[model samples]
Target: MTTIHNGVSPRAHAVQAAAALAASMGIGRFVYTPILPLMHTQSGLSASLGATLATANYVGYLIGALAGILIPGVVRSAAVMRTSLVVLIATLALMPTTHDGSIWFALRLVAGIASALVFMIAVSALHAHLRGQSQFLAGWGFGGVGLGIALSGVLVFVVRFIGSWGTAWLASASLAVVCAVAAWGLTPEPRPIITPDAPGTPSSHRWFTALVISYFLEGIGYIIAGTFLVAAIDLAALQWVGSGAWIVVGLAAFPSCALWAWLSLRWSRPTLLLVALLIQAVGIALPAVIGGVGPALISAFLFGVTFLGIGSIALAIGAHLQFPRAVALLTAGYSVGQILGPLVVTPLLRDGYRDALLLGAAVVLGAAVAAAVLRFRFPSDLDADPRTATSTEEVVFDVR
Candidate 1:
């Protein structure tokens, strides 16, 4: 009765497959994050150019996310993933040759698009097939982000021996190729039959819109901490701590997601999300204003603890809102916020990136406000089971 493509049993296969895809996707996010310290000295990168590169990638992500949401074909095919991976590999390889700002920006933009497509398709597949699975399993699958972050960080450190960023790209490309192949078999194609909603289906659009706004604000706020925290730490002249701190963040992230999601069963999901935003805001702002190594590590730990489970929580919010298209809209809005994060922060780097942190804090605080608004505006749905992520439930939140 069960098939490997559809989730054979135990959900182990789905988790494995999801982890592989998440690792591949997350490897791209942090590849350049750790190297911010070395960017200007060894790589001839300027603050503005660095910002441009980040913007390009995020913009591409926005475009690609839209494409995936609008065009169903983009989400269904193994070939789409293969092509996206190849693009990711090639774009990363081109990073060293980016002497001209225009070319570099354009290439990164392309890479972002490819990354968005790959990420969307892979996560959608996992959500579709891994229904009824424990949120812990899903959290574990997403923990691949930690693994990817660790591997990429180590690779960057290794590249320091060769003193070539290009080699780092090549090595990462090789590893991604391996993971891609392993993941290929887990990828899904559409089945002929489609299920329709039962009578008196819930309408959760208001909640969905609320979640989208919160997710978008989170995208902006989190990137400030995630992308430039390295630079901020480096600016404080604690380069070693800064570099190692990311490893801590990655390590903490592995288990925190599942733990937090599990906690949601007893607590309010919106409250948990607000707490996460507060924690992240503190992390971002602490390093922005503080100078001590103790502060830096504390910030990293808090960020790591809260960063995971965001997308899942947003998706859960959508489910509660009863919105038919919440996932697509949320992903799109979040991608846009992601694209804007680096762009808005570039000018502020001249001010020691403090301005960026302040902005990020503002954005995250905005998510908290949005969450509060959702709670106050939609009180009736809070008591209901909004997390319809069961195997028996449809994978509608997988629109990303």
Candidate 2:
């Protein structure tokens, strides 16, 4: 008989967690990218304002991440997740009801906070319940973000022909409602029994600092593409091409974490991290350097394949270091990088998205360089706990 926890099977819990991720991350946070073009054309939102809005959302995400780290109780509470889901849906629904830019900014900001909370709670649940299960199950759960992205992209793509940006937001809200229902039964991670650990040699700060710098750079570079890829593609490609490419990105991302996780079993993570970042840099620059329907789609695929995987590898590396509050520190650095991404590129946006994308690619290459530094004399065997051997694999399977 299948073991049940609080009336939900482990498989069922994973499914629910996936649904929650799809709702909060895929639809709640990312639907903005596809809808951005519509707002530009129909709502008359300026490029600078759009960048500001994106920044606001990132700021909110940082706040939410910090909250989870500081409170501890929040990540363990089902009520927090439920409330965040409701708030997320509310933000999406209210977004279409106003033409005021400040309101839009506030809504996106709240949505960001809610997205972070939902994401943390869902991930915690997975880590708690899915222990000892096949790592593939966790990968699939993380892929929920990609699934949500694809669904929202399809919704916006169809709405482009028939409705305004408002309609797109409303439709996305409805889709989120469906996902929320599916995820409603998800259980929060139960609190763990506390135990002390054996003392060990201190981790090398030099390598850890290199890893932080690389991951921080990754945050800046990836968010630029994440926020503007569709818009950038729309500039040079056909009308359908932009949204179509986003769909491709989502589809490619859906299986990417699982693929990366499986590969880590064979290759060292630092090697894989460098490889992923280098490929992502190429993907980010492809559309800018070579504009065409083909290049856009190829660019989308490459980006989708690596962005989440990079986060997985970087966090796993942090865990291996066993730095104090490593996950929180890395997450904070990443969140700050995300907030800075759009602002750094705002001046470039005045011309078009091309210059911004080129800059983003350059930053990612910088991150790859840092990753290269980390690989030199990396302490892959730093953690002597045999029980923690799978830590790298577990972290790699999770989406950021």
Q: What is the lDDT of candidate 1?
A: 0.69
The local lDDT score (0 to 100) that residue 172 gets in candidate 1 is 66
- lDDT for 386 in candidate 2 is 20
What is the per-residue lDDT of model 1 for residues 230-311, given as tens digits with 9 covering 90 to 100?
7888788556676777777777776776778787877777777777787788888888788879988888888888877666
Predicted model with the maximum TM-score: 2
The collision pairs in model 2 are: none
What do the candidate models score in CA lDDT, each in turn? 0.69, 0.86
- Name the 10 consecutive residues with the lowest summed lDDT in model 2: 386-395
What would the per-residue lDDT of candidate 2 be over residues 1-400, giving only the tens digit for each residue?
4567888887898889889999999999999999999999999999999999999899989988888877878887889999999999999999878889899899989999999999988987876777666777777888888899999999999999999999999999999999999999898877755333323245567787898999999999999999999999999899789999999888988888888989889988889999999999999999999989999999999999998789888887777776655666688889999999999999999889999999999999999999998888888778433224121122122432
| CA-only RMSD, every prediction | 3.7, 2.7
Off by over 4 Å in 2: 1-3, 195-203, 384-400
